[model samples]
Target: MAKGERPKDSRRLSRKKTKQKIFFDEVCRMTKLVPKNKLTTYGAIARAMGVDNYSRHVGFALGKVKASDGVPWWRVINSSGRISFRPKDRVGEGTRAKPFTSLQSIKLAGEGHTFTEAGAIVGWTKKLHDFNR
Candidate 1:
């Protein structure tokens, strides 16, 4: 308990928050790389960030960004090519019973993409944008 010393738990929490902020920033940077008519998955971004299991973390970070940030958050989706929405944990907005906001869908469509009734992107495999390439 020196004047400049932090508690062990406090130190760890500080480091964790720093790492989370760095990860969130990286996620936004990568999301910006996706072009129109293309898409990337959560796991794909996690992999690019050098973490194999950060898919949820990727989604969580994007959920925190406001649309005015112009980071193209809608360009990222699930690994299976389906749009995630509602359930709060899914797309960062809406409830489990409420339909997801059309903002994402509308933005995506304006970029020349289509979705099935089930919210799965049509011909998604071809639209997959690979960062490694």
Candidate 2:
């Protein structure tokens, strides 16, 4: 955090790890809603756990869980609340990018989350209080 020190990447990496650890338990609790109800998004988990700016960090934690831990990692999505698949491109074609949005979407869908036509959640955080409340 020094002057003219472009340590943004390092700072982000460290914060990502720390946020992942802090939000891990909350993410697990949210994922437990799956197989009975629908999937919960990373944003939901982060908000529930009081993490204002580390929503995607929750996704990283879930990915780590999928790789090694046994946490229920298939219950997260984007802010839009949709489960969109990664755009597929045939051989010798362009657009082979695999955005994490699709992965988050697929995992949430696997847990039975219902999406609207525009991909928003059916009934997301309706009862939650607003900032002024």
Candidate 3:
């Protein structure tokens, strides 16, 4: 699919047994559908994929994507509308020496997404793209 193109029929993922690679691919596809200046929660993607408990897994799959893959991984945030650290970032949630000024924040800011002084995206719910469309 072209960049940002939603899967023809994957508004929600199938629950039937599938390979882990397929699950990862589905996550990538769903993520591609998020608009440029919009956002979505990891949990929202998991729920849309029929696995509400898999938000962390969603984060993992997104983390594995390369920049060339056309997945806007920065458009995803935690349910609280805050940018989160990946396990590999070596920074625990509360241990960031600085506020949310990571590269991801810069990217989101470049796209017109606003954030709080502490780094939480402002008007997050209004910017969310639910993929059902």
Task: Pick the TM-score winner.
Answer: 1
Return the TM-score for candidate 1, rounded to 2 decimals.
0.80
Looking at model 2, residue 37 earns an lDDT score of 45
Cα deviation at 17, candidate 1, in Å, is: 1.1
Q: What is the TM-score of candidate 3?
A: 0.75
Candidate 3 at 15: error in angstroms? 16
Report the backbone clash tally of model 3: 0
Query: Per-residue alpha-carbon lDDT of model 1 for 81-114, expressed as tens digits?
Result: 9777634434435676986466677778899888
Answer with 1 or 2, whichever has the higher lDDT.
1
Model 1 / residue 56 / CA error / Å? 0.9
Instruction: Name the candidate, 2 or 3, with the larger TM-score value.
Output: 3
Native-structure RMSD, model 2:
8.7
User: For model 1, what is the error of residue 77's alpha carbon versus the real structure, in angstroms, after optimal superposition?
Assistant: 1.0
Lowest lDDT 10-residue stretch of candidate 1: 85-94
The Cα local distance difference test for each model comes to 0.84, 0.56, 0.83
lDDT tens digits by residue: candidate 3, 1-133: 9999988766544433346679889999999889898899999999999999999999988889888998889899998999887554432245456532366877888999887876689899999997778
Whole-model lDDT for model 3 versus the true structure?
0.83
lDDT of residue 129 for candidate 1: 87
Clashes of 2: 1
